[model samples]
Every structure is written in structure tokens, then in C-alpha cells.
Target: MKSKTVLITGGSSGIGKAIGIYLTTKGYNVYGTTRNIAKYPNFNDFKLVQMDVRNAQSIKDCIDEVLTNEVRLDVVINNAGVGITGPLEETPSEEIVNAFDTNFSGPLNVIKAVLPIMRKQQKGLIINITSIAGYMGLPYRGIYSATKGALEIITESLRMETKSFGINITCLAPGDFATNIASGRYHAPVIKNSPYEKVYGDTLKAIDKDVDNGGNPIQVAKKVHGIIEAKNPKIHYKVGTFFQKFSIILKRVLPDNWYEKLLMNYSSK
Candidate 1:
């Protein structure tokens, strides 16, 4: 049984919870973070700690507590993030800031807190949760795409900067999954006369439908465990419906106009 400690953010539900529970069964010591532990009164599968990724101090404190006891932190999963929707022009400025803070900067905060400990240990892994949308901006979820894309770039850069110290970092660009994310997703208020109102509403509904009927979160957790066990992991990995995963290939090979039209049609479905 592997005894290394793994810390995962946003573990109260969805992929985070799935990964936490799955890894606990695999014999790895698991610690999961959530802003409110009260919601999980019966959460006994693994340890759950209070953490808010948007707050740097909260992140630091959580990692400190884990390292204070665990002594060696093995894996860090940056999965705690939020989603925001609407056309770029109409999305509230504060919402955009909050989205980026949670999605992009949030990972950096966790990584910053754990890097020193991992580097000292001379071995660690950081698995960033990006998205298929990170590969390309979706119509109404542009900010969400941008935030995840930023994390992907950050992960790539971090891999090059940390490998010499034996720290590995990679991103998981999942297509869509059945999760509680939609319940918490924020939508920008479209004005009664906004030009984007029609397409935005249609696209939002389609995206939500796609997510509501998407892949099981356990599939993602299993891949995360495999990546953690592997001797060498890729810079980026994809998990989700076959079509969403294939979109990456299409984005690379298809003509610009064709791909744009395809994306538009799909988003507007």
C-alpha cells in the first residue's frame, strides 16, 4: 500500500470527491479541501479540511496544516474552481475577476504553497484541472475557457521550471462531466435588448445539457490515479465524451473558418 500523502482542492463534491475517495481506497493518504465542512457532516471516506482557493492565506494555512503532520506531500490536484457564463461584453467585471481568481490564480496559490515542501522532498506531482474549453473558447463561456487556458499554460511552464527538482506538473482538459458545477455556475445578466441574448441563451442551455449528460466523474478520478502512479506523465491529458475529446484534433487539423463554424453550430445547438 502506497503511503504518500495527496492533497486535493474542492473535494466536497464532483471529481474532487471522487478522486479523494478513490485514492483513499488505493492506499494513498488523502486530504481534501472544501470551504465549508458543515455540508459534509458524514464525510468519512477521507480527511476533509476547510479551504477557499480564492484566499491565499486560506490556501497557505491548509497546506501548512497538511505538511505539518504528513511530513511529505506527494500530489496536489488543482480542481477547486468556478464557472461563469455570458458573452464577454456583458459579463459583469466583478464576475470575470472572480472567475479568473478561482480558476487561474487559484491553482497558482495552491502550487505556491506546496512547491517549497515538494521541492525540498525532491518529488511531487501537480495535476491541474483544465477543460476541453481551455483548448478553444466556447461562445458564451469565453471567460471560463480563458481561465482554464491560462492554467494550462501555467502548468506547461511549471513543468519546465520544476523538473530539475523532480516536481511534475500537468493538466487534465476534461470535455464535460456530470457534476454539481452547474448548480453553482454564474450567468451574466443579458439586457433585454442585447444582441447576444439569443445565441447566449441557446448556447448556455446546450452546454448545460451536455454537462448534465456527460461522463462519470469517477472516470476522471481513475485517470488521475493512473497519472499519479506513472513514471512519466504527459503535459496534458483529455477526459470526457469521445466527440469533445476529438474536437481537439479537429481544432488542430481543420481550417480556421470551418472549425469556427463547427464550434458555433455546436454551441448554438
Candidate 2:
């Protein structure tokens, strides 16, 4: 069997890095992108590229580099993203815009850059790393959820559009996972004399606590491997602990008022 080549964004750490390491062991030629490549110690059998997803030129250059070096691309995983956590009112406009650029626009740029190559090959896979927040709304995570929500729609459209070309698009919607993403969250600057200061402050604290108890990133990576290698991949894969599954199911079955009350109560304490 011929080896498959995969290009992964944000491959230096977290789920992306875990997937990259696993795929390499599975005999895949993996090329991953990272802004700071030197941070990751030399890992065996994985190639690293310096690319920023927020920059269109960087994304195009990264894809071009992959084409020039590998000659063929079998898979493209859009996993590079950032988290901005705060209530909509408290979150600054600039913060929201940056979040959208990194989470939504960045993926679009990467996908656009890679599609031409994938179209020519007529056979390829695109896996997008979304969050459960994409499906269920969280109290203080409006901006983050909006970005994931956009990704969900884009994935659906791409799936339908590329059906004739034999290209598969799958969105991996993992619940909270223990990753640097939580600690690395960018908070909107707090106003010194704002009425919502206490509320926003409390929300941030709750978010941090939830993230601390999230599931392991390695588990999510294993699920990603399965998704990529599966003969017929599902459009959405929800991988998380029992609570995550329960919450998503609840959101679907429960009434709006009941769900809102439950979420508010849960987050309040």
C-alpha cells in the first residue's frame, strides 16, 4: 500500500501534535504547521512548517511548500484555532474579530488553498476540528461558539460541494479537552468601572475551572485517527466524556427554558 501524506495546521502541540505523532507511527508522511517550530523538541519522523493560519499568504505558501515537496496531498486537517472567552457585552469588538479571523476565516483560507490540489487529485480528505460549543450554546462563550458554528456550516457545504469529486469532509466536534488552549485563552480587556465587571470576572473563573477538568487531548487525537482512517467517515464525531455527550443530548431534547436554567445554574456554581 502507498503511504498517505497529511498536512495539519497547529501541529506543534495539543490535539494536532498528538494526531501528527500517531499518524507518523501509522506510516503516514505528516507535515504540520506551527508559528513557533522551535518550541517542539525534535520528534521522530514528523516534518514541521512555520505557518500562521491568520495570514492568507502564509497559508498559501505552506500549501505550496507541501505540493513542491510531497507532490501529492491526501489529507488536510484544519486544526489551528484560538479561544476567546467572555460574555458578548464584555468582549471587545477587536477580540471578537480576531477570534473570527483565527477560528473561522483561517480555516476557510486553508481550505481554499488546498482545494485546487485536492480537486486535481480527485480523492482527498478534509477534517475540521470544531468544538461541541458549535452545536450547543454556552453562556460566556458566544464568540468562540460563533466561530465553531461557522465552521460547522462551512464543513456541511464543502461536504456537499465536493461529493462529485470523491472528497470527504468531516468535522470533529470534541468537547472540552485538557490542552494548552484553555490556559492560552485570550481575554478581552476588562473595563475599570463597568457594571458587568463582576459577572464577567466570575464567568472567566468558571471557564478556567471547567477547562482544568476537561478530558485528555490524547483521547481526542485517537478519535481523529479513527475518523481519518475509517472507510466511511461520519459527517460529525462527538468525542468527549459522559457529561459532554449528556449535555449535547440534553440540549436537543430539553425545552429551551429548562436548558437555559440548567446551564445558568451549572455555571453559576
For residues 33-133, could you state the per-residue lDDT of candidate 1 as single tens digits? Answer: 99988898998989999899989889888887887888789999999989899988888899999999999988998898888988999999999999989
- Candidate 1 TM-score, C-alpha based: 0.97
Pick out the ten consecutive residues of candidate 1 with the lowest summed lDDT: 189-198
Cα lDDT of candidate 2 equals 0.85
Estimate every model's Cα lDDT from 0 to 1.
0.90, 0.85
The number of clashing residue pairs in each candidate reads 0, 0
TM of each candidate vs. truth: 0.97, 0.93
Highest lDDT against the true fold, candidate: 1
Please write out the lDDT profile of model 2 over residues 93-126, one tens digit for every residue: 9988989999999988888888888889998999
Candidate 2 to truth, TM: 0.93
**By how many angstroms RMSD does model 2 differ from the true structure?**
1.8
Stretches of candidate 2 exceeding 4 Å from the true structure: 38-45, 189-193
